[model samples]
Target: MQPSRPLDVVYDPLYTTSTSHNKYEGHKRRVVPNKRPISIKNNSGLVSGPERHKYFCRPVLPHLQAETPEVLYASAHDAANIMSISEDLSASTRSIGMQTMYRDSHAQTDPFSPEYVLPEGAVAPEIESLTNLRYRKGLPVTQAEIRMIEHNRKKKALKKVLPPMSDEASLNLRKRMMEAQEIMDLKFRENEIDEAHARRIEALQESLAEREKQSQAINSERMRRLEKTLMLEKEDANRRNQHDRIKELRKLANKRQRIQTILNQGSKKRDLIEEYADYASPVYAPQMRNGNLVRKSPVPEVQFKDHQLMTLDSIRELEKNLPPQIRTSPKNQFLKRAPLMKKSRDQMTMETHLLNVESAINKQHVQGEEKLPSSPYKGQYRAILQRPSTPNYAPQIAEAGSEVNALRLLQRLIRGRAVQNMMYEGKDRRAELIAELRESEEARRFLSSSFQVPAEETEITKSAFSHVEGEVVSELLDVLQKELIRNKEIAKVYDFAQKAAEDRHQREIEEGARRQLEDLARDRHDQIYCFVTDIHRSTANDYIDSIFEDAVEDLTYRDSVVQSIIMTKVIDPILNILEEENSEDTIVKDLVSSFLFPWVQKHHTQDQALLEKRKYTSAIQALLAKVSQSMRI
Candidate 1:
């Protein structure tokens, strides 16, 4: 049987067809439901609609019928009459509730109706199983019982592990354990040594194979080189044999040429002049191998002028007065002033020198300082460089755009022909502007045909009070149109000027550089000339002569002019050195002094300290220990 539902629904017997009023007694459906239509899902017969009641329980359950109706009626009647109290009420008030909600519910319902019966209390089951009953345990476990059990089982096991044996037995057991451990260690070490031996053998085999491979490669390379050498030797022998054969053929050709010449000559022998003429044929121009022109020396006497060919007396005097380096050193005599034509000189010396060494050194930072500043505004000048500069197209674009805009404005004014109308106001003026702009084919044809529009002239007398506004209007329009055309033409001219400036910028820069170079060269030439003149004048003066003889004795010369030239050339270098500015000289000199002084002083102090330590060395250790204390105090 299915489990009982929690909610029990009681059907009303009045809805069931009552047989009591008829001949039969039970209340049940009298009509049989039509054979149910088949369900497509389950293929089972179904009873649907109001006829489904015919399949409902028709059992004569008189037991439920007696109390079920009455209980249901009571519950529903109580629910109808009942009103819930609000949460605001006290619990005590609710517990001591008012009169029964169903006080008159029993009277409202048919208490004595034949179809209804009184409700009874729910019945209890008559039998129940007793095996699942729970009861208290017999006794509780104590600590003494737990201890007794552990002593019997756990204590015996622990005592067996940590045995209560004699010392000799324990020692015997340890000896056995040591023997087993030693045997195991020996086996493990043997395994490790075997592994190492196998690894070493494998490594040696690999190395041996690698060495064999290298040796084979070396042998192959040696054989290749030997074969290459043999090949080269064979090629060399072939070249030598070919050269010898060619040389012999050339000699035979010379013999044939001489015979031919003898036959051409009419039994005449050549003269000595003719024989030497071939040898004397003018050589190719005596010039630089690279085709540059060869320069000749300006000075007539080379060694004597340079002080290389000095007399014994001059040498002795020079040695006594001159510093070692200034007394014609080996470098001065062996200078490569003019090296062989085939070779470059160690030092290049021009025959006509424009810049002296002094000027060159002075112009290291600024080559043309006298003519040009170190830097200039680059935009104003043309750029002169090996590589081209990127162009700045912004100005070109702007100028072209402005010119186009001006031209467009001028064209619009000319084409629209609304000048007079625009000058005035009102709709009529605007209409006149439109009419003037509109071209008439008839007027164009008449003008092209050179025909005139015949009209009667109505002359009027001129008055002083006449309006002059219209008179100047045409003139003003003509002037305005001319000005617009002039502006566009001006813009075109300005654009041309800007382009010309950019295009010729490079040439202008080159010109400026050339001018600057010329100026510097002129200045240097004048400076050298003036310096030589001054030295010559000074040599003639008694005071200058006495001063040179006494203070500057090393540079004495036999020729006054040579001495003047040398002095001028030499003094300029000293002057350039004196003119130079060096802010770091003092700083670097002080730094060197600071470092040298401390280092030298430190060594001196160290030597002195050594002597002091020797003197104190023989003193007692106690005294030496107290020395630091004494110095500190």
Candidate 2:
């Protein structure tokens, strides 16, 4: 019979509050040293746990309270039991709601790390708590089984029995049979062999006669035999004769060259002596043709003239006499070759330039006395002499006797004068100004900035039209100019539209690239995670098989070798799935506590499918859904 649980270990409500209505605070003293910060000051704690208030300060958690009735203040054994039960509850709740595996997957690891291979039994490592494994290879062997094993192995190798005349023994028997048959043939006599040979000879003769008859029944012409040997003999004899003749000619030519070289050497020595001695020979004298003799000089000068030559005398003369401007070394090599551009092209040479300067100086002296009227310019007042000296009392200059008409006076005195002075004055008044300027040539050449062509003399110069040389070229050039102008106008109007479209397209491309990068990162993470997950799924069966047969095996809850196997195998996978794709926010902690925790409580603890591992997969899927909801991924 199985033993029952001890009464001492069995737990019940340690105490029920004597007065359930009111609460008490100060669950413990706050003078304990701890690694974490404490809320103690001046030997006084905040009255409760880390979080406390006057009205709310009490035992922080109901489980934290060790309150017991005096009657129930029993022995240390009961206290030990209480502590153990409390520890178990705390451990179960302490799981981060996750474990070490979940923390590792989310950590910032080294970038250069090679992919890690997961240990066996990462997923539902064991199916049922009581299950074990057995393998057929590990069965026991016995001493009497040895011969039987060999016999069976041989039988399996062949798969059947051998027939009589089939193996190597059969081959040997065939070889012997062949030898016996060959020996039996030797019983025939030599005379029989000779008779057979004679018969073969007769057959050969008959075949030969038939072949001869066949050869005779053909059309034929006599062919001459080529004597290759005689042709080779004749070629050798001709070659020998030619070689002898060539040798004789070579010897004669060598003797003639030696004799000529000796004679030429003697003549060359005599010629050298004559050339060096410079004797008065007839060859030195020039021959006259008819009565004419060679000219004494090669060239006759047209006239005696002085000219510069590149010589030491010319260089010395330049050094002593030339001005610095003309004798200077080369410089300004990069300067463009352009004609000198004077401001006034009329003074193209030095004489004209000097004339222009002299005249400008005279004009400046003449106009130097010009001055302003006053600092405060008066718009109305002016010298009476320059004011046209209007008639003082309607002088009879208009000849009042002629007509006293108002319209005629307006036309003559106002309109007529204004038209004559302002409209057509260029024809008369311009000529008068030019005559006056000519009289005062000094003023005409004035350097005053205010001097300008009179308005009366102002004429729009007409452009001279020289007919363009190439009509086709001119037309094409005009078309090109018009095309360029038209294109510029089009671009000015529509360029902004094209630029805006290009900018929009570029932004779209960048946004798409950003999304692609995000997708690639997500896929990379999935690939790494899938590597681990594949191992986990594969080890699921291996874990089941390892229970008894394997040296090391993942324990189920019933046969736990480490901390609860459910934490590593079942709970960890769910947590990993939740952690891998989640941002892990606390905003949705209520969802996990209210929805997921309750679901696991209702399903995992009650469903029979946990034995079949369906509960774990379902639980993980549900957890993943909650995680996704929290992350909003």
Candidate 3:
């Protein structure tokens, strides 16, 4: 069976009232320490076990019924009992509110907090008695009452222990204290006088020091100013002398240069004034030829107004010939225009909406049938009077305007301002004609179909002009034969030329392909060369380092000879192989182990030679590895 949730813990009303309402305010008296915050789960349900069941009994929910007969019957009975108990509890709780039961609980705690402490004698006996009678409550002592009780107890105990002082002894003690105060006052005055004297002496010394510091600062400032002035005067004098000497030297140098120039080229020497005077020409003057120094004619100055007027005229001309303007604003858009002329057909003929002819015909046929007698119809019909076919007719339309207008004729013949204007007018006329043709139903119907020559015209023309005279035919044949012979010759020449062109184009294409191949080859060659150079440059230092390391290791003559032999044979060959395009790790290893190792072993069987050989081979391997790293391809 499942258990119900435990009751919530409620704080005692007396404790709540005693506790400070404002948590922020500081308490003068030490507050009664709270051991810990009250937990609703731990402290709730003070009355537990069978004692709790006597009052606020909560029934446990019955377990789910099982298939077994015994368990199922027991569960049914338990559920029934639990349900009845819950209903009764709910009824009781409804009458006496849940909060009233919580308030009636006996469990209570007190903190004696100072906030709820009442003034002395504030609660009269009569009021306390009335509260106890009406509310069935007892007055509990406030925090103030507790403190007062404690203080009075302490005071009574102290009064029984300590005796009061006599009046003569108190007066004598006061007199001694007064005499001691006088002596202290005299000593304090003497100390003040000493401090004042010392302060005066210190002030005098400070004043003297301040005066000395000011005088020294003033004297130093004057000396610095005097030195600066003298230094500036000396610099000015030196600068003036330098300037004078430079001027004199410059004048001498100029004179010497002028004399030298005159002697060498026989050209006239001019001073700054003369040089500037030669440039004294009007600002608006035309530039002259270098040697002539004279213009053949002066350039004419165009006026702004005339220039602007010419530009404006060109702009206006361009604007006048511009294409039709487009309407940008819908509000100002062009409205549909009235037809240029009245439509030729009537409104009824123009209407495209088709009428329901079947309805009309059926109505007419019904009326006719109704009017006629109903009779058995025969297959044969009597011959009736034939109706004459409607005479083929068309409306005879007269021209609306005068047949001949001299002014209109003259206007049509008048030449436009330019050929462009004439073409524009022609284009406008054609556009108008096309629009009119599209607007006309009959014309549009005729134009929608493919056009063909009239059969009558074709027959007439074929018969009339099909035959040619013998002489003319013979002449035409001769001319054609001559033309065909010429065309044949031309075709032969064209064929040869085309073949030549094709051959040349093929050669050019081949040449371009060859050149591209050469360029790619050259680029690859250059890249390889740069890679080789980088490898050589980067390995040069490593080679030197290896040789140095080898020299340090090998001190004897045979070792030196072995080193030289290794350098000339092993290292050089390995480097050459590393630079080669087909160089690989196997090839390098073969060069070092197969060729160099056997040669070294044959030349020198000593241990040092063997050691040097190993070092050289290792160095060669290192060099090859470094080169391999630096290799681009």
Candidate 4:
């Protein structure tokens, strides 16, 4: 026919439907019979139900089949099995037959498919043919090949065409193209290099800016803190200076107060002295004058009375001339001698001078007048004068001696006035001094209360200076001496205290030095030594060890010696001198017994080797025996 047509293939969905229904023929739906004739129910003579149903059905319903879950599940399973079988068959066949069939279908003419026609209302452009080009024999006419051919044909058509520019212009155009490409490449390289450099520059700038900001902040903070510190320091310094000035003012005020007090005391003393001088001047002058006027020579000249001597001799001759019996007899001799012994020479002279006294006494005696005694030397003479003596004359003489003793006592009273005056002077001076001191103390107290020291440490500083001025050792010695003399028990207590303090001090020093040496040994491995040399050395190492031990022993001995010196020379002597009750001999014995003897015993006991080497044990025993004997004494 028009060119042998290929066989047409048709698909019949009705045949598939009929065959599917036959397979499920027993499960088909049955029609339901109408049980009653169709009738309209009249409501107000209108067909409302059918009319409303027709109105509701006016809108189109979607023509989609509703699928049950079982149908959808079974259909999905069947499709999955079919896809798996198709995939397996396609994999085995490599889909070559399918691809051939698809190509064939794509080439069929159908208006609905893209393979049927070109696009609507679109036309292909016209192409001009080349006349002077020779055809290539074996070139394939693919689209690309066709494009190449068209390009060659265009070149042949333009074979007679001249260049639009001269040779120079063309060369310039080629050069320009190369130059543009070079420029683009250079720009790209520059962009890449500058990108890294730019990033580095940006980072450095940012770092610099950050550092500057931090530096400025630190500097500002430091300056602010420094300013605050400076202000505080300046304020503190000003406060200290003010305190110093105040302290100086207070001290000056105190000094002025002390000076004023001293001046007032002086003025008061002077006034008192002037007042006392009024009573003292006149009385002292007269007493001095009377004393000078009545002054007598301490020694008296010796003189003898001639008349009294002659009378005494004449009396003795008269006594010798008396009868031998009366002279020998005790009663007559006593009677003769009593008047002679009783009457003094002065009384005889007074009797001789005043002869009337003897004459009157004799006349009064004759007339029973009081009989006065005659002198013993004048008794014989008195017998010649025929004078009588009174019996009461002996009592009068005893009374006269008593009166003389009273006068002597009066003289002693006069001598005691000098001692009273001395006592008065001492008491007066002490009173005035005490008054002045009291006034000074009052002034000092007022000043101290009124003006305080500026510094808290100012009082301590002043006390320290005062302490430097006051020698502590001298004060301690004075106190010790006073206590020893005043109270023996207190003195013993103080002595014990002093000994305890000294022992404590020595122990502290020893311990401190020991600690220091231990530390030094730990730190530097060194030792300190004190030594006494031997005359000869033994083996070297043994000698060295012996020397070290000897050195330590010597040091111990030296320490003992130092302790002895401190106790005996410094401490014991101080105690002994101040001990008022203990006699010198007793103190010496006590010291030797209590201290020295014990010390010797300890020394001998401690140094057995030395005692043996020196053969000193016997001597020590002897010395100890002597010491024991001395202590007993």
The candidate that wins on lDDT is 4
lDDT per model vs. reference:
0.55, 0.53, 0.57, 0.59
Q: How many pairs collide in each candidate, listed in order?
A: 1, 0, 0, 7
Output the TM-score of candidate 3: 0.14
> What lDDT score is found at residue 29 in candidate 1?
40
Across 397-439, the per-residue lDDT of candidate 2 in tens digits comes to 4576556676687778897788777767776758888788786
TM-score for candidate 4, residues paired by index: 0.17
Q: What is the lDDT of candidate 4?
A: 0.59
Candidate 3 Cα deviation (angstroms), residue 382: 99
1-633: candidate 3 lDDT, tens digit per residue: 642522111322222335547342334222455466676356574767755545842255565632222222322235687798689887845554232322345644322211122334443222221221212222255553444455545544544444335687766765676576567557656766676656765675577679889999999999999999999999899779856865765575566555444333322222433432344432223245522244332334444565543687887876677765532324666888866543433333224212333444454565445433232232123233232333322232234235446556666666444666888889887997877776796756655552565878667756665554556788999999999999999999999999998678656655765688699999999999999999998899899999998887776767889999999999999878767846588677876898888878877768778898999999999999999989955
Model 1 misses residue 598 by how many Å?
30
Runs in model 4 lying further than 4 Å from the true structure:
1-175, 191-199, 268-633
Query: Candidate 1: lDDT over CA atoms?
Result: 0.55
Q: In candidate 2, what residue range of length 10 has the lowest lDDT sum? A: 125-134
RMSD to truth, every model:
66.6, 57.7, 56.1, 59.0
Superposed Cα deviation of residue 55, candidate 1 (Å): 73
Candidate 1 has its poorest 10 consecutive residues by lDDT at 124-133
Candidate 1 lDDT over residue span 1-633, tens digit each: 763752222233333333545333222343445465576265356777866756854344446442343333443224333344344253455455343324554532112222222335644121111111222221134553344344435434443455334798886775676576567557656865676656765575577669889999999999999999999999899669756755665565566556434433433333534433343321212235644454442223423363643578877766798777676556445656653562232123232122343443464434334344233332234223221233355688787998889999999988677775556555575776667556566557756664343332211212222346556777899999999999999999999999997557645554665678699999999999999999888767968779778665545444676878877899877756755754568657877999999999999999999989987775767697799889999
lDDT of 4 by residue, 113-194 (tens): 1111223354422221221122243222345346545554554444334344558987677567657656755765686567
